[model samples]
Target chain A: MSAKIRLYVEHPLGAGQSVPLDRDQAHYLFGVMRQTVGAQLLLFNGEDGEWRAEVAEASKRSGVLICQEQTRPLVLPPDLWLLFAPIKKVRTDFIVEKAAEMGAARILPVQTEFTNSDRIRQDRLQAHAVEAAEQCGGTYVPEVADLQKLSRLLDHWPEERQLMFCDEAEVGSALALASETAAQAPWAIVIGPEGGFSEAERKRLHALPQSHVVSLGPRILRADTAAVAALTVWQQRYGDWG
Target chain B: MSAKIRLYVEHPLGAGQSVPLDRDQAHYLFGVMRQTVGAQLLLFNGEDGEWRAEVAEASKRSGVLICQEQTRPLVLPPDLWLLFAPIKKVRTDFIVEKAAEMGAARILPVQTEFTNSDRIRQDRLQAHAVEAAEQCGGTYVPEVADLQKLSRLLDHWPEERQLMFCDEAEVGSALALASETAAQAPWAIVIGPEGGFSEAERKRLHALPQSHVVSLGPRILRADTAAVAALTVWQQRYGDWG
Candidate 1:
C-alpha cells in the first residue's frame, strides 16, 4: 500500500551508502513509477533482511537509494519444496508466483515425457518468484532449481525428504494421504504436466520409498490447477495449518 | 478419447426413436467436431444418465442421433455449494468451470459492496458450467443460481446449511471449525471478491449462527486461489475425504 517497493538481492545494505539499482529496476522505479530524490523506498537482501531507504539521487538512466535502518530480520524458510512440470508461459509464471507466496522452500521444474515446454527461462521465472515474495511480505525467497529430467530427479532424490506425488489416477482422496504424510520430516509436492505423467513415470514414482501418490479429486484438473490444488491440500494437512 | 464423443442432455434414449439435437449442439457435434452420420456419440439426462448413441443424420445446421444403449446410471452430486463473488470474465469462467468439475451441487454468485462486475451474464456462466460438467464426465450439471446481493442471500439463508467463510484475517491455522456445525447439514464455501468483504459484512457474517470464519493461511491469496483452496480444505474436512 505504500510507495512501490522493489527488492534486489545484490550486496548487503549499510548506513549512508548509495547502491545503484539494476537498469530494469531503475526504469521501473524511476521511469514507470516516477520516484524522485528524497522519496522513501524499501529494500531487502535475503541475508540482511528488510530495510527502509530513501532515494539519495535520481537520474534518467539510473537511481540510488541510501539505506536508513533495518525494518525486519532475516528468517529461515521452511523445508517445503514444489516440483512441477512446465506448462504454458503465463501459467508457469503464475505457478512460480503462487509457489513463492505459498512459502515453498524450493521450486523445481521437472521435465517429464509429456512436458510441453523444455525451454524455460530460469532467470525470468526467478524474478517472478522474487516479486511474489516481495508482494506477499515474505522475508525468505524460495530457490528455483534448474530444469531436470524426471528420471534424473528420482535418481538423485534425497532419501530423507518425502515426496507427495499428486497422482490423478489414485482412487482414494488426497486428504488421507496428506494427513498421513504430513508427520514426515521434509516434504515436497510433485505435479505432472498437461498431458499428465506417462505410465512408466507413474510406476517409478509408485516404486519409490519416499513417494506417496495422492488424488486431488474425482475431476480431471489442468496442470496449473493441480499445482495450486496440491499445494493447498498439503498446506492444510501439514506445514503451518496451526 | 474415442472420436471426440459429443455429449448432450436430452430426452430419454430408446432403441429406434431418433432424437433431434438442438441447433447449438448440432453445430458443435457436426460443424465444430466434424462428425458424420455414422459417428459415435454420448448423451445423458439427469434421470436415466449417460448413453451411447450414433449420428443418424448430419446436416450443416442441425443433426439427429439415435440412442443405442445406456452406459452409466445417473449419479447424484454431493451436497456442496460454491458461493463466490463474480470477478473478471476469464476468472469468473474459470471458477464456474472448476466448481462444476469439483462436483459442486450448486454455484451461487454473491454481490458484495466491493464486487466490481455487477453485469454477470448468468446464461454464459451457466453454459460454461455445462461445458465443464460435460468435459469432466459428470452426469449431473451443477445449477448456477442467479446473482443475489450478499444481504439478500443471507436474509433467506437456509438455517441448516453451514457456511464456511474463507476469512483471510483469521490469525490461527485453517481447520474445520467444529464437527457439530460441519456435520449437521449441507455446506457452502463463501469466497470474497478481489477487494474482500467490507468490515460490516464481515461482522454480519461472523454473527450468523451457521457461519464459521476459517483462515486459509498466513499468506493472502487472490479470490480465485482462495476459492480453490477453501473448497479443497472443505472437501478434505467434511466432504468425501474417504
Candidate 2:
C-alpha cells in the first residue's frame, strides 16, 4: 500500500530537514493517529517534491519530522483554471475537492448573474484543496482563489488563456477542444451556476473571442457534474491523462 | 424556465392519462412544496416520454395529475452499466447520483476483496437515483442493483459487452477507447474500491478478453472521483457525450 499519512506542510523540504508541526498537526499525528517517534509519513510543501519523513519528536502539543528521502518530483498540472459558480455548501466543497484531485492548476469561484451564492469562505475551501491533494497522492496542490465576479474577471481576462464555457444551451454541439486548440496551452473552463447563465451572460460569452462554448452532452448536467465532466473532457483531449 | 417540479411516476404517460400519486409523493408535493390544485408539473414513467401534468385532484392524503401533452420523447441513456465496489454511505450515494446524472443505464455495487462495504441499502440508493433524475431533468432513472461479488459478475460476463476496467496500477497507459472499440457498443465501466483491487483480481481482470485496462490520470483518484472521471472519459469517447 502507498503511504497512509500524507501531509501538506509549509516548511521547505530536503534531506535531513527537520520540520516543526503545529499544535493541530501535533495532536493529529501523535494523539489522534497514535504515531510515535520514528513513524514514517510523506510530506509535500506545494513547491518541493514529495519526501519521506520520520518523526523525530512526538509530544502532545508539538512534534518534529526529519526528511529522509525524496519520494517523487513535483509534477505540475497543465495551465488550466477551473472557474465555477458556488452552490450549496457541501456541493461547493465537493467541487473544490474534485478540482484539486482532477489536476486543476487553479480554482476560482465566480459569481455569475444567476448565481445563488454571493459569498464563500476561501480558507475553508483552500483547506479542502490541500486535503484533496494529500489524499490523492498529488505532490502539487492547486491554488484556490477567493470568490470573484465573473463579469469583472472577463473584462480583464488574460489574452493568452482560452476560456472553455460549458453552455447548457449548446447541447448537441461537439466538444471541439482538441480540434480548436493545441495541447498544454493556457486554458480555463467556466461552468455556470445551477440556474444557468442568463441570456445576457450567454450573449457576452458567445461574443468573446477567447471563449469556446461547448456542450457536456444532450442532458442538462448539474453544475457540479458539469464541472467534473468539462474537466475530464478537457484533460482527456488537451491536458494530461492521454 | 423549465418545469419547476419533475417527478418520476410508474403509470403510463399519455394524453388524458390520470396518474395517482403515492402517499409519500403526495406528502412531498403537497405538504413540503405546498402545491395546490391545478399546479402544473412535468412527469415521466421511464418507458413513456415526459408529459405536462396538472394537479387535477389535491387532497391531504393523496392527489391526482392529469397528463396534457407530450413534452419530450423518452430518450434512453447509452447502454452503459457502471460496476463499482461500494464505499462509504454518502460517497456511495454520490456515485449513484452521478451515475444517474451522467447517463448510466444500470449501476451495480460489486464486492471486491479490498472492499470494506459488504452490504448496501439498495432501496436507499435507488431512491437517490430517482432524486438525481428528478433534479437533473433526466427522463430515465438507472436501476441500482444489489451488492454482489466482483468475481461472480466476471464469471457471468456477457461476451458481447466490453469492460472498461479503470486500473489505477496502469497509470501511464493511454485510454485507447476510441482506437480499440467501436462506439455505441454494449459496454460497462468498473471502478475499484478505496483499497484498490487485489493481485488475484487484477490478474483475472487482465486475463479477461473483453477487459480494456485504461488509466484515468497519473495521480490516484478517490473512488467517487474515479467513478465520475471514468464515466466522463467513457461517455466522451465511446458513449453518447460526443
lDDT tens digits by residue: candidate 1, A42-89: 787767777888987787777788888887777555688999999888
Candidate 1 chain A least-lDDT 10 residues: A173-182
Among residues 3 or more apart in sequence or in different chains, the pairs in candidate 2 whose N, CA or C atoms overlap within 3 Å are none
What lDDT is obtained when candidate 1 is compared to the true structure?
Answer: 0.79
Instruction: Give every candidate's TM-score on chain A.
Output: 0.90, 0.96
Task: Give the CAPRI class of candidate 2.
Answer: medium
lDDT of 2 at B186: 89
- Model 2 ranges with Cα > 4 A deviation: A177-184, B177-184
**lDDT of predicted model 2:** 0.89
State residue B126's C-alpha deviation in candidate 1, in Å.
2.2
Q: Show the colliding residue pairs in model 1.
A: none
Query: Per-residue lDDT of B1-242 in model 2, one digit per residue for the tens?
Result: 23689999989999999999999999988999889898999999888988999998988889999999999899899999999999889899999999999999999999999988889999999999999998888889999999999999999999878889999999867666444444546899999999899999999999988888899898888888899889988877777776
